[model samples]
Target: MSDKELTTKKYWEAYYKNSHVNKQHILTVCSYYSPIWEIFISNSEVSKSLIEIGGFPGRYLAYLANRYNIEPTCLDYNSDLTQIEGSFMEMDVQHYHIIKEDFIKFKPKLKYDYVMSNGFIEHFKNYDDILDLHVKYMSENGRLLVMIPNMKGYIQFYKYLVDYKNLKIHNLKCMKLKVFEDFAERHNLSILHLGYYGGFPLGIHQKINFLQKIIYKLHRLVFKYFANDKLKKYPSKYFSSAIVGVFEKQ
Candidate 1:
């Protein structure tokens, strides 16, 4: 199936319908243990106006709003964004806007200081088109942060074992840091940072069978006891769970 078909509104609707807003899950993502925190800390001087494309549940966006006191806007195609609004309210994020519209067709009057997407762009075969949308809505010198799950090596192996269907939607070719580097050079955007992030015990955010769960438990125990610190210190393309890029429109 094509990328478009794989990531249809119906698909996302079904996804959100089954997903509940877990405050603990959101807190964990914002915590220091997560590599996402590293990105936030590194870019501490980022702007006050931000928008997140495909930001459902608004976990990262809400965290950014709370942490940095930035105004946040969430643009998503799904109508289920009411749940995200509810989540924001629960998080005590009082000031935020949720736009229910296809990002490709979205035309905002005001540009954002930061354009961000987490696990968003890989859903498209023509990812440059998505990247262009990010740049399009960004103000001059604004930062664009794009993050994707690293499905290139052992992480891919684990994803295939646990969630093959979910794995099929992502464009694995675009997961490389070189792709972002080349794109930044071509688009005249300065690459502030681009690299693989996080390490070991892949984030298998999908349902698994009993045997698979037991195996994953064992895997976690082994990593916790022996390799957690070492793996985290040495996040490579093959071992890291995510690939992140921060670029400035110059």
Candidate 2:
């Protein structure tokens, strides 16, 4: 598909026009990232400034800001009707800055300590250029994070085969981890961490069928009761529905 047909201002404006479903999905996804951000804060000095390139109505950043008390900037094409109240869940949305502009052309007076996007890069035909744009505003030694739907992963592939109609509307590319590793190399960045998250058999948000959910529940019972803690945490490449990569600017 052409870049014009891909995710644009109009695309998102329409998507979030009645955004209750989208907000719920964003909250579900952000719950996973919240723990990851805690790990980042524990290891390094607190990140003073962070930005989400395509975040609109900024619920994800609001969740993070509430936990870490960091300054957040949401750069997106336009605003949505879904507003996350400052006091709603005790998040201080006052520090969150929402910028209505094209991320490619956005020039910040100050760089951010952490730059991120959730399901952002895959929208473009030239994703490598998008990655470049994401890293452009990072401070020295800052972290870069990108998360995308795993169209290549086993569980998602199964969905594509059976539930093609539901998946077709997103128009996502089958991006793999190697593409990100290559991007890091070309940009002179160091890969800090890379992994998959959100297993489909357990993650309800994948629109899993009833039979699969029942089987997954039974498996979870066995795994929880019979399996060792280490075995329970075993990584499965094929099961994850999303892939996350974090890189540091060199």
Candidate 3:
């Protein structure tokens, strides 16, 4: 409720007001193999009641509606993105519901069978606290899906070369896994699976082709070694470009 939380309203409004990355790329990656595909489709039966935190423009939610036959209302602090679909409500995530407002001002009263946030929390300086927010809303036996910038992704290296705003952690932190796991445990959520992409093991994204079928297969051979038992055993903050956790609330 202080100035710190208040900034989210303006920050996110600017984000949603701007043009996004090419929608085609989103459809190609997310529509195909990302957790977005798995979470959206697997829980399609409960689509009508789903509530997406940080839902922007309803792109992924719309994917669920179109591809998985689920109707989901998206929520964000921005009013503009909610215009076309009418499936949005303006509410801040940290301090919502103070004066009979939306779910953002206070703890969520509605329990969703599935709660998801993708590429949203990583922007926070304190991602640990950000994730705890989601865990608070998770229904018993519900699933929480999160996709952040992968620390080990091919694109991450490029960020160092070309952009100044790349995730600073790789440049700063020793480990990020413990941070993620701690947040999950504090709320009694268990992570089921985690993956790194471009198809895995060998650097699948290295090939200039980007669509070379052979490289994808070779990367399959690569995934097993890179994400070996030892590394995978450690907290997700220890490795990978981004992480996805399928959490079941206890």
lDDT of each: 0.77, 0.66, 0.51
The runs of at least 3 residues in candidate 3 whose Cα sits more than 4 Å from the true structure, single-residue gaps closed, are 1-26, 34-36, 39-48, 82-106, 152-157, 166-175, 199-241
Please list the residue runs of candidate 1 whose C-alpha ends up more than 4 Å from where it truly belongs after superposition. 1-5, 32-47, 205-215
> Residue 55 in candidate 3 has what lDDT?
72
TM-score of each: 0.87, 0.75, 0.61
Writing each residue's lDDT as its tens digit, candidate 1 over 77-103 gives 877766787667656788999888888
Query: Candidate 2, which ten residues in sequence have the lowest lDDT sum?
Result: 81-90
Candidate order (TM-score): 1, 2, 3
lDDT of 2 by residue, 1-250 (tens): 2453355577667655654434445567568666457544424545588888887656777777766677788787775524533322335456567677777776777788878898877777677777787777889988888878766655566556445544554435536777888888888998877776654533333456787667557656754455424332554556555777888877
**List of clashing residue pairs for candidate 1:** none
Alpha-carbon error at 16 in model 1, in Å?
Answer: 2.3
Ordered by lDDT, highest first, the candidates read: 1, 2, 3
lDDT per residue for candidate 3 within 1-250, as digits (tens), equals 3332324566556646755434464466456444435643365355334557777655565555455554454556565643325321221111111112233455676766667777666555555666777766666677777665565445345334333233352222212455557767787777665544322223332224444455445544565555445444443432444565666676
Provide the lDDT at 66 for model 2.
60
Error of 1 at 170 (Å): 1.4
Candidates 2 and 3 compared by TM-score, better number: 2
Candidate 3, position 204, lDDT:
30
